[model samples]
Target: MAFVLTSILGNDEAIKILSYKWIWSEEFLNKIPLYLLDDLLRHYNRSTMEEHKLLEILAIIKKDFQKSSENERFRD
Candidate 1:
């Protein structure tokens, strides 16, 4: 849809986007174990799967938030 949207360059759209949290949601916010964030960080220190690492490293934090809209959380 790049052709459908206006160009963000030199426009106020970029600023508007940066100021907002498009990725934030009830599910993602709740799933992120804030209390164990430190422990989670430890996982990145060791060697791990390349694809998973690529997604975690290259993907923006907001992009992950956006992805949550499509992917669902596990239910008990």
Candidate 2:
């Protein structure tokens, strides 16, 4: 997962995703590998790393969060 995350952080998809906001919370940011966030803007658009990048990332994360929430909800 770390490798995949590292690779994606610079990929087109990552760029596309980060090209809008920057709101990386300490919690979510913690889960990412230490190196993933350092040069994110190099791969992603500068717009994505704005302070609001955290918010934009939150938006994108919500989708995955929703999916996992459903699975967890059904687990028990």
Candidate 3:
């Protein structure tokens, strides 16, 4: 789902859609690239969702980022 959205809308726009619509599940969220997640977090203050939900999403994004970074380091 994230892949399709990213392909069709590009990362920035996809993130905007996801953030605004609150349409992302954990699996979908995990599918988004870490860079896009970072972009989302950077602009989170501009989103309309409740602060706690946004913080929860940020935690998931951070966890995914750490896991991806660890995997890359392990592969290297």
Candidate 4:
């Protein structure tokens, strides 16, 4: 968790880590907390350019988070 959390530090570090090569995957993305994930997305949305691959990865992660929250909502 701390390892993943480190990605959130500093301005645009999240975008750099996420947009660069091979630093992330679906399994790795799932390990990140939703709040931190949202924060990462904020940084990404603010700073990233035209990295299509990173956009796709982030979209999938966001969709999964939405699905999980929906499932939890129904369960409660």
Residue-wise lDDT of candidate 2 within 1-76, one digit each (tens)? 2323335455664544333232134655565445445645453454344445444544555555544432232221
Q: What's the distance in Å from true for residue 11, model 2?
A: 19
1-76: candidate 1 lDDT, tens digit per residue? 1111123233454333333343245654454445334433555346332444334432444455354442243323
TM-score of each: 0.23, 0.28, 0.32, 0.29
**Model 4: CA > 4 A from native:** 1-50, 70-76
CA lDDT of each prediction against the hidden true structure: 0.38, 0.44, 0.51, 0.46
After TM-score superposition, what is the CA distance of residue 61 in candidate 1 from its true location, in Å?
Answer: 3.3
Segments in model 3 whose C-alpha atoms lie over 4 Å from true places: 1-47, 70-76
Would you list the clashing residue pairs of candidate 2? 21-53, 22-52, 22-53, 22-54, 23-53, 23-54, 23-55, 24-54
- Which stretch of 10 consecutive residues in model 1 shows the poorest summed lDDT? 1-10
List model 4 lDDT by residue over 43-64, tens digit each. 5556553455345555554565
The order by descending TM-score is 3, 4, 2, 1
Assess candidate 3 and give its TM-score to the true structure: 0.32
Superposing all C-alpha atoms, what RMSD in Å does each candidate have to the true structure? 12.5, 11.8, 11.7, 12.2
Compare the candidates by lDDT and give the number of the best one.
3
Q: What is the C-alpha lDDT profile of model 3 across 28-75, one tens digit per residue?
A: 456656755675556544654355544565555456544453223222
